[model samples]
Target: MSQTVSDFIVQRLHQWGVRHIFGYPGDGINGVFGAMNRAQGKEGEIGFVQARHEEMAAFMASAYAKFSGQLGVCIATSGPGASHLITGLYDALLDHQPVLAIVGQQARNALGGHYQQEIDLLSMFKDVAGAYVMQASSPAQVRHLIDRAVRIALARRAPTVIILPNDLQEEPYESPPRAHGTLHSGIGYSAPSIMPREADLDRAAEVLNAGKKVAMLVGAGALGATDEVIAVADRLSAGCAKALLGKAALPDDLPWVTGSIGLLGTEPSYNMMMECDTLLMVGSAFPYAEFLPKEGAARGVQIDIDAGMMSIRFPMEVGLVGDAAETLRALLPRLKPKSDGAWRQSIEADVATWWKTLDGRAHQPAAPVNPQLVAWELSPRLPDRAIITSDSGSCANWFARDLKMRRGMTASLSGGLASMGAAVPYALAAKYAHPDRPVIALVGDGAMQMNNMAELITAAKYWRSWRDPRFVVCVFNNEDLNQVTWEQRIINGDPKFEASQRIPDVSYSRFAELIGLRGIFVDTPQLLGSAWEQALASEMPVVLEVKTDPEVPPLPPHITLQQAKNFSLALLKGDPNESGMIKGAARQVLETILPGKQ
Candidate 1:
């Protein structure tokens, strides 16, 4: 008996434990899709999601991969469809995620006489993959290339590309079976670094013996090390605060976990990151150079697995290259918990004052509706089990700063590259990953519309979706790339604010309705309760679109002289029109953070 290459690929993917494939069918790829259709949903596994764009398919699959801790799969025809996968693949690479991209070729016979949709995939993807292999040129090549590609993807925990030809789609293929191979799971952690072990604990102990005004800037790597992180903070009589991504690694309500850092970071974190005399970096490599206090402003120690990252962003007196959990555990027992809590009251008072000031600045009184106000109101209302995701913009800063976290919650985002289109697909994948937990996306108007919201179809089509109908999207529809516009004002020195910054005024409610998802569009807070309540009730996907004042300028996370001037200029841009008002409000918000006052 024999089967086509397409059939063999699907069968092997199944054996590889891939239960879903995200992609759009194309000319040369029809055979592959048909083959997958034949083998799907059997033995409690394997299915497909037909995405509107190859890009979205890749995104959704990438999210699924990240959430499940398994390799994600995507299929595309050669040329343009294959090209569409680059962005998502790049995202996976940055996150160190695993993905297998299987592309359909023109056919074995059509080897580059400029055949339609032809691509030198080897050349095109060499930079992006751990491995790239085209259709088995020879019979002996198939087993090796396929096995090698799968191995590389798992080993590198990045992308592996396998290009199959149309003619080989069903080439009579047979090979003797080998022993069941090890999966190579490829997931491993480096041992905790322990150098000057006695002194490191002694140094931390010295700070604890001396005072209580110590704090931590915990990062993503701090996850699962919660007990040790908290205990170390306790030993030093220091409290803990997290980076935006570090939100999940620790609980939000804990007295020590003070929230994120830098601009759009929580007021408590801002006050503490600056106020603490000794700062400890637990598993995070925070990159915002401007946000850190002057060198030696606060004596610091950083712990990380990658030696290079020990103190790359900011200098540290003691750098430990190791796992956060192991390092923290070893440092304990030897370190003493302080008897009298020095500086805790002072730090607490300052933290309280900082949050009080931010409270007024974060929310507003007047109308046309502020985007900040919308995000502020919604963040509190979300469920305890929410897996929140955000798009980069003014809203991202707001979400990172204000969104409350519970132990059950998880948040994901595209770091610094700040891509706009990932919100919805991430939400879908979070739903797939957690299923029972609520998944919400807090997106700006420009970001929410990315990928054209077609992921709603994928959401609706899933046979078993996340419960609580909690995979809802609350979009801050301000209708402009406000961050870019803000940059134009602060750095570019543009004068009068312009309405042209608003690219489009698409009716989001209408679009959500078109997709059969519940759509709630609002202009007033009076409608928020019902809109929110009903949206949460939806059995399928829900889109709560709130029209916001486009001119609402986001406030800085914390303030400095340079920030004061930039915000002042942004205020200067505000005219009587919408953009002006936003600038004005932004400037007003900055005024509250005037130095010495905080």
Candidate 2:
């Protein structure tokens, strides 16, 4: 029997080292599904992970690339299935992750006939897969399309697409003939050793050495260069701050390593940025300019692999385009050690006080439970090498500020897209990538209701296959879209419009129990610690739900005068929960000024 085009495409992907493909099944791509079925149980055959929705599948693929540092692949049928993947692909594109999307298209006979499920996929995918997008017209074209899509996605660190017509997928495979207009492509790609010129490194070092106070900001690009970042910081006696996506790049145990920097940032980080005389940004594109040093107030140096991203956030005296670790290694020798230790001492003191303030606030009383306490207690109990993920909302604020990361642990969320419904999928992909380690996801009720609940079924389907059975999804049940509610008060000066902010309260724990997973519900403050213990020790996957007070403010590290006025204006306009809001905000504020007294 002749091998089909789908068979050859699968074989080609395997040669390029694709281990798994995440997506849902559809008739439009039935040929590929048949190919995957036939190839199963063979050596080095790719595995298929079935997701509840195409969107979640795409999110899983994006996250798999992020956690495993490999090329992630996702597949779907024609039309709606293809459209659903756009959000997840954009997540990978904005975060600069390498991913390839393979989708089915209408049969060749139906082209331009406006047949059912015959949308123009190329036009739809052009923006997200702008690096590369192609359709296979003949069996000979499938090989190069697969080869180039994988190569380009990896080389450019962005998503690429290849559309296969249903009729073509079933046709007999053919290789391109050795003639003009025919091309042959091969497998394999390796990142080049990139480092800045010696002259550039010398200039960056000079800028650092001349300043008495130096500050460093690290992002996801610095994840692999942890040791190098530490060495540079020690030599310059600088305090290092991490962007949200780079939380695990430096351990919070280090005295001078301030926590997340930005709206969900730390006090020490805000102070360091405001006071430093020189700044060094490594592999981070943290978008907020207000959180950085004032213009012309500090000399700047930046290092990034992408030349386009270099020096865009802040004006730099020197911009070095290279891999983070290699560039920092080259720059280390030229840096002269700072003899005066005063600046380092001050930064350390501030970091220490900030932690104390956080502890005091966590211990303050709430209507039922303080959300900050949930994260703070989990910080000390997290197992070594555990992987954590969080959804975007008020819970992320706590995840950023309270959870102290240790060395050897990994964590990530929807960094660039900041999309909801990604936490559960991210955790699922993380578990598949590293089955030996435990994975936890911190999600808010809003995101849980959005689409994460259905993903719990995906977890139930695959948990037994994992070597370690400890996968916990902790849900903050606050009954409100707390982040946007607070944003209304602080950013828009509008009251909490109850209709939009309030969400229906569902028993997330009970739903877990119905699906054969352990469920633990906590409403009292005293039960929070033990609930986590019970869930982590369970033999099966668990959902730990905590009833938290929505009125508790997710206060920024530093509040501006305008923000203060806006908050006051919202209160004057009669917010629905005005009394509880006042009390929660006061208790948190008082804890900072009068520690342990609240």
Candidate 3:
């Protein structure tokens, strides 16, 4: 029997080391599904994971690439199915994760006829998969399309696309003939060792050595260079701040390692950026120039694998384009040890004070439960080597500020896109990548209602297969779009328009119970600690829901005068929950000013 183009494509993907593909099935993609069915349970065959929606599937693929450091793959049908993948693919593209999307298209003859489910997928995918996007015109083209898509996605660390016409998928496979205009592509890609020139490294070292106070910012690109980052920081007696995506790049236990940097940043981080004489940015594209050092106030040096990303955030005295770990390793020997210990001591003191302030804030009383306390309680209880994920909302503010990450623990969310509805899917993919480790996802009510609830079924379907059955999704049931609501007050000077801010309160815990998963609900702060314990110990997947107060502000590290005025203006304009908002904000502010005072 002759192998169909779909069969050849599947086999070729496995050859290129694709272990799993996430997507929803459709008639347009039935040919590939048929091929997958035939290849199932065979030696070296690829596994397929069916997601509730194509969007979630793409999110899972993006996260799989992030957590596993492998080429992530997703598939969908033509038109809507293909279009549903755009947002998630953008998440991968912006975050610099390598993902490949394969979608089925209409029959060749029906493409221009405007048949059902026929849309111009090529133009739709052009931006997200701009690194490489192609359609297989003939059976012979399938081989190279698969090869190039996989190779380029890995090489460029971005998303790639392949559009397969249904009719061509069932046709007999053919290899490119050994003739002119025919190309033969092979499987496998190895990242080459990249290093900056010696002259560049020497210049960076000189700038660092001259400065009395040095500050470092690390991002997702620095994940693999943890030890190198530490060595450089120690040599220069510099303090380090982590971008949200690089939270796990350094352990929070380090005194000088300030937590997340930006609006969700720590006071110590903001202060370090404001006060430092020299700045070194490693592998981070943390946008928000306001959170960085003032223009021309500090000498800057940057290291990144992508030349385009170098020196974009802040003008630098030197920009080195190379792998983070490799470049840092080369720069380390050239750096002269700084004798000044005063700057390091000051940073450590500020970091210590910030943690204490956070503790006071987390312990402050709310209407029922303080949102910060939920994360604060979980911080000490998180098992060693656990993986954590969070959605974008007020929940993320706590996740960024309160969660104390230890060495060996991995965590990630939709970094670049900062999209909602990604936490559950990210957790699912984390479990697939490391089935033996426990995975937890922190979500808000808004994101849970948006699309995460449906993914709980996906969890129920696959939890028992995991070697470790401790997957917990902790939902913050605040009954409001708390993040954006605050943004309205602080950024827009508008009151919380109840019509848009209020969300229907649903029993996320009960929903989990209906699907054969454990459910625990906590309405009081005292129960928060034990609830986490119960959820983490459950053999089945669990949903831990906390009835948190939406009025509690996700306060910025350093609120600007304009933000203060805007917040006051919103209150003057008559917010619906004006009393609770005042109380919550006051309690949080007082905790910072008068620590431990009720």
Candidate 4:
């Protein structure tokens, strides 16, 4: 059978389980877009999404990957369109996401000449992709390259680029596929191996028997194995806390869950993990070596499915390469309870005390509204199975601390390398993939502006399709880098820094109304409840724009004491010439933290 270069690329994507592709049509890639359209109509496994910009297309693809645990696919034309995609691709790379980016190139014969939009794409994207490729002049190499690209993307957890020359896209090809990859259920996040060697279980049991004060620190890897993890924690009578990703694994409201660890991680979580005599690391390989306590004789039992990662980031005394849940289960039976265990109660009390202080840390009557109130307010309206998407920045850590995710409700993110404009598209994918479930987006004004706000239209389309409309997009209108500004006050001596000074005003409410979505704008915390009430009850996609102070403190990932001091200095040295912003911040913070005094 004869197939065009475009058809070959589209077909290969189907073979690799990619469904939705985001792209903008350009002259350089007209051939590929046509092929994509034909495949969508006939084959129908993959679908096309027209994007306003190249960056949005890549952002959508990256978010889709995290949501589905599959490689996300995006397309763009060569030259400017291709060039515009670099930022989004960088986002995908830094965040460790799997994405396949198809870009157009000048015709094969016109490569070296000064073509209108010629760029050294392969060389430019060398650092950005997990793998890179140029279109083959012949049909045979195209097939091989496509296979290699997908493998590299999935294996390395980064984006891959395939720049197609205009002529190659027009060429004809035919063949049966050479090979397909098989799944090894024992590895990766979804199908965690439950069976561990008896020796490992025995070792864990011995550790529990010897340790008087043990703490179990679970990470995202521990998800799906929550029950198993808890069972092990119970067996050891160990105090339990989580890494940020682990937030989805266990119920945050659970009395047994101590708190989350690391930067922006709760104080209760930090103290317990730091003070424990023996720490059991599960599912998560937290890269911050300094966040963990230095063990003398106290040891760590690290368990993960990825064998290579057992001690890749943190030193461990006993490295168990298997599923966290499975290893815990096997180990639980072999271990006897330790005598004179003081860690669990003491840690639990400390954690509870920290929770009490969180009221002071996050909540207070503020005129512009506290960011924490956004999540705390949004949670009650969402159904138990809602899917929440978070952007990086103050919103990311704020939502993490504020949102209470039940097991079925997923909180998807780009982890340590937080990307700002990913939430809207990610939420769109979740709504598309799980039509029955509700999806909410917690975004910052700065973040939402970057996504072009066209996502509202998509949400409206989704809402009309389902008899029950259950999507909400909430934008916290804090027109600054509130997180960074908090540090500026302490370190730079400038209490207020307008990090978002260049951003234009966003009348998100009016924009949502223009796009057929329900728009509810609130400037105060009190108004949030009513806005949320109406938003939750709306028959279509709803948008809640909350006017928040642009000077909130950051929800940091764990920072060193020295780093804290440096941040304080940044606040002290903050440009005093920007005193208006400083006063604005101090007022906002005072309003939220201390009322009636001023």
Any residue pairs clashing in model 1, and if so which? 4-170, 5-169, 5-170, 264-557, 551-582, 574-580, 575-580
* Candidates ranked by lDDT: 2, 3, 4, 1
lDDT of each: 0.69, 0.94, 0.94, 0.72
When 1 and 2 are scored with TM-score, the better candidate is 2
Report the C-alpha displacement of residue 587, candidate 3, in angstroms. Answer: 1.0
Give the per-residue lDDT digits (tens) of candidate 2, residues 174-260.
Answer: 999999999898899998898999999999999999999999999999999999999999999999999989999999999999889
Deviation (Å) of 62 in candidate 3: 0.4
lDDT of 2 at 509: 98
Model 2 scores a TM of: 0.99
lDDT of 4: 0.72
Query: Which scores higher on lDDT, 1 or 3?
Result: 3
Q: For residues 73-122, could you state the per-residue lDDT of candidate 3 as single tens digits?
A: 99999889999999999999999999999999999989899799999999
Question: What value does the lDDT take at residue 416 in candidate 2?
Answer: 85
lDDT, candidate 4, at 360: 56
Regions of candidate 2 where Cα sits further than 4 Å from its true position: none
lDDT of 1 by residue, 81-137 (tens): 888887877777666567888887777777868988888877777777745545556
Judge candidate 1 against the unseen true structure and give its global Cα lDDT, from 0 to 1. 0.69
